[model samples]
Target: MIPLRALLYRRGTPVMTLLIITVNVLCFLFEMAQPFYLRESFIARYALIPDQPHALTFISSMFLHGSLLHILGNMWFLWVFGSHIEDAMGPAKFLLFYLISGIASAFVQFIVYFGSPIPTIGASGAIAGVMGAFLVLYPRVRVVTLIFVVIFVTTVDIPAAFMLIYWFAIQLLSGLGSLASISNAQGIAWFAHVGGFLAGILLIRLFREKRARYQYR
Candidate 1:
């Protein structure tokens, strides 16, 4: 099932969430504004490549996306979940958590791929970390999702635990398949998603403020 949104109430401003989205959009626009070859060169230079990983790319690459749909999906997930996370964790730490998660995600993907030359870009990895934090912070929350399979299509509300677990499983299986194929260029960096998620699960505590951990209402 494809998650639509979490069925929960959120108050206060999600300023950081909007800011991040704006920054991503601006970055994409900047990339697009350049000449074709310059754009290509820019992306290649900033994107995280496993064979020759650059320290800065670990963070820069998260803001880069290969296509429109890529950024849309990542931003959608971020909008759907990031607000509450930012509200719960507080905006400052939430931002820090996000950057750290992105770096960790790239690092993990680099380790898994080891020597692949394909450049990994996009915000999904960091978004996955937000998802991991969501799952841990609000596992009981329900998410309205679209269930689509072949000719079947429906919408339903599923518990966050189930949805996240399913999502993680898909990433793990796809990552394993990618490994077996020894190809990280099939489009999706599954392990990046996995690593970011795992980082969220483990690192969220350090980022979470002293406020009540469970703020669902």
Candidate 2:
């Protein structure tokens, strides 16, 4: 299932969420503007390479996406779940939560894939954190989702808890499966998703403010 939007209403403008999306988009645009040869170098420089890890790449990697589909999916997930998280935590706290989640995610992936050469790039791990927080805060909220079943296609209003738990399960299972494989050519950072989600679940309470009135849609 693919989430189209959360059914919950917002308490205030999700200023930080929008700003983050803008930054990611701008970064992608800049990435595309580089010459083909230079682009490879640019991505490698900012991406988190577990074999040659850099201090800044943990943060920089979140804004770099490998392709159009990548950024679109990551940004869409962020918009669907992140706005409400930002509202619950406020702008400043939300920013910190996002960065912490991203860094945590990167660390987990680095540990798991130590000495691997593949570059990890994208906002997925950080966005997974937002989804995890949403599950904790609004499990009952319905997510309007796009579902594809065989040849048939449809939309469903899935409970946040169910949707998120299912997503997490997939990541956990995938991560475990990757460990048994010998190739270091894996594309997705499954462990990063898992770690970010767990971090979000653990950290949300610390960053979240007093309960706010739910603006249900």
Q: Tell me the tens digit of each residue's lDDT in model 2 across 164-200.
A: 9999999999899988882653689999999899999
The candidate 1 region of ten consecutive residues with least summed lDDT is 208-217
Pairs that collide, model 2: none
Q: Per-residue CA lDDT of candidate 1, range 1-217, in tens? A: 7678787777687999999999999998898888987888899899998898888999999999888888888999999888878877789998999998999899988998888888899999899999999888889999999998799999998999999999999999988887767863448999899999999999877877667345444
Give me the candidate number with maximum lDDT: 2
Model 1: lDDT to the true structure: 0.88
What is the Cα-based TM-score of model 2? 0.97
Clash tally, candidates in order = 0, 0
The lDDT of each candidate is: 0.88, 0.92
lDDT of model number 2: 0.92
Lowest summed lDDT across 10 adjacent residues in model 2 is found at 178-187
